[model samples]
Target: MRKEAQELYRAEKDKIVLRPFTAKYPKIAPEESYRIQLALIEMKKADGAKVVGKKIGLTSKAMQKMLNVDQPDYGHILDNMVLPDAAVFLAGELIQPKIEPEIAFILDRELTGPGVTPTQVLAATRFVLPALEIIDSRIEGWKIKLCDTIADNASSARVVLGNSPKRVEEFDLKLIGMVLEKNGDIVQTGAGGAVLGHPAVAVAWLANAVGQFGVSLGAGEIVMPGALCAATDVSAGDLLQASFDGLGTVSVRFA
Candidate 1:
């Protein structure tokens, strides 16, 4: 990253308390965008936030093609970004909130390095749970290039994990289906295959990418393996539900 670009990135990140950035700075390349993201992560760490785990984005082939990226991208999810079940999220805190259904893996062992396989991810995982990711684009309307989204923490906002956890061997995850319901009506449907052929593959991609940054997936960290379906716009008073076959269901009500 150029010195001027780095300075601008840091300035924008430090000004988070004022208001999130709703537009992108022009001429930022993909690599430079990741540099800004890492810098922001460092800034957050300096402010006392603990890195919880990573989030994989654009795991779906459609999303990958739409974003014109061949592979997935990841972002750091801070501990403070997690919300427990039944918790309320102030609508005003987010810029443009969209919801996605995903499968979250809680690791029982640390995973690092490239060439990690999907089988390895399944073995390292303690359990898998249904998750609803509230993705708030600091960039307005969630409209931005791949680099813009990456710099914005893959549009991460808050993640809600379901109570029940299913063992990896207990279900046929590759064929698992997910139904997304809004206000009691099904809005979208998808399957684990929608996420880079399988959710575990997404985890593998995330593990490798994090390794490149000199980070490793730690035990007990929650890794969200991207969304199984396209994001749905959310509104206050709305009820969102995601049900995964055999794994279980997770729901949240907007206030």
Candidate 2:
């Protein structure tokens, strides 16, 4: 597992895609995958990376069903993974980069529990921001199973956060609407409810899920509940923007 972790770590650093571990380790369990992810994270930390937050993936029922998983997966978000809204970057720098719009929570209070509720998640949240998650896979051609993705840090790459921040009580997140546009054309539209019925519910699940590992969703850390829609492919010279009903817009440019 440690050797596999090293391979994944090197893949990210070298921007190289690798064959899915499942091809060789077909019987790999989800638990083993998470352990590999943790080991990979430790490798990043040892090299001076700082964990700034956490990201939850596969929150939608459709995604879970497609992945043959019953629950969402998580990955640590490092400080370097964050980018400002309207940022531009080279497309060739990433391996199979894609984008997903999400609601990000900046917690005001620490949340730790084996049974955290959505209400508690809201209480602990300081504000929610419009976000764009740039997801990439270290696995070749993005062929991955549940265990494959779990071990690849949930395929997290970069995050772009919007300027607007609103408290949970300000609006009903479950009904919040979002429209994704690429090159000035609408590509996808979705509602927050697509994410585990409500985004906060997913956050609550994350808090409890990680609690079993003795990890707490810390105060002031950004927590991305999940994507509102399917991720869209990214390419050079492309401009993408996501507009939420009340959260304003966040965008990125691929150079």
Candidate 3:
């Protein structure tokens, strides 16, 4: 089941894949599914892919309700999955992509959690950067359960980072606001508090959670806290921008 899922993920890329894991592997434990994810990440590393950072997903209560999950999930971001701020994303290069406005934490120090706190997260954070997470599901029609998505690396695909990062001491993150726009019109608006009351809270959760799996989020690694607002679909010729009130802005052109 693990091997087949990995094959389908690689072959489908951004396209709809046939036969989800749950349909064949009924009653599979979420922990087992996460083990599959870890295996997949190891395979990527073997293939010369570098682990750029980690992302927390379904942290928002809204998204948790949508996905019918009580807890959040984490995924790896490969070196090639990151793009510069304002870069173009070829629509043809991805399967049914969706964009979410998020703030990224650049860690200045290592953190291993079974007890990581939000305050410790902020202290370890080097700065905050505006970000847009591009998520794509390999399953057909985005149909997935928690185990399915977890095995599929939490449905992560690409991330865009603002070139400039603000120091942690420079601002109060809870008050950070973001305006998400498509084609120059605001489509969604939210603040840092929308994500588990604060983005650092989400990051803290990720540290402690992933730590149980023997994964330590290292220093200088970028951590993508959950999206501030709901995700919006993307298509060819679409221009999307996420502007944080004080942090800065990042844009992606879909072509």
- Per-model lDDT: 0.80, 0.92, 0.86
TM-score comparison, 1 vs 3, better candidate: 3
Cα-based lDDT at residue 250, candidate 3: 95
Cα lDDT tens digits, model 1, 198-238, are: 89988998888777778789999999999888888897888
Per residue, candidate 3 scores C-alpha lDDT tens digits across 93-125 of 777689988999989998898999999999998
TM-score of 2: 0.97
Evaluated against the true structure, the overall lDDT of model 3 is 0.86
State candidate 1's TM-score: 0.88
Which candidate leads the pack in lDDT? 2
Q: Candidate 1's error at 177, in angstroms? A: 0.8
Candidate 3 positional error at 107, Å: 0.7
Give the range of the ten consecutive residues with the poorest summed lDDT in model 2. Answer: 61-70
Q: Where does candidate 2 clash, by residue pair?
A: none
Q: How big is the positional error of residue 253 in model 1, measured in Å on the Cα after superposition?
A: 1.1
Number of the predicted model whose TM-score against the real structure is largest = 2
Per-model TM against the reference? 0.88, 0.97, 0.95
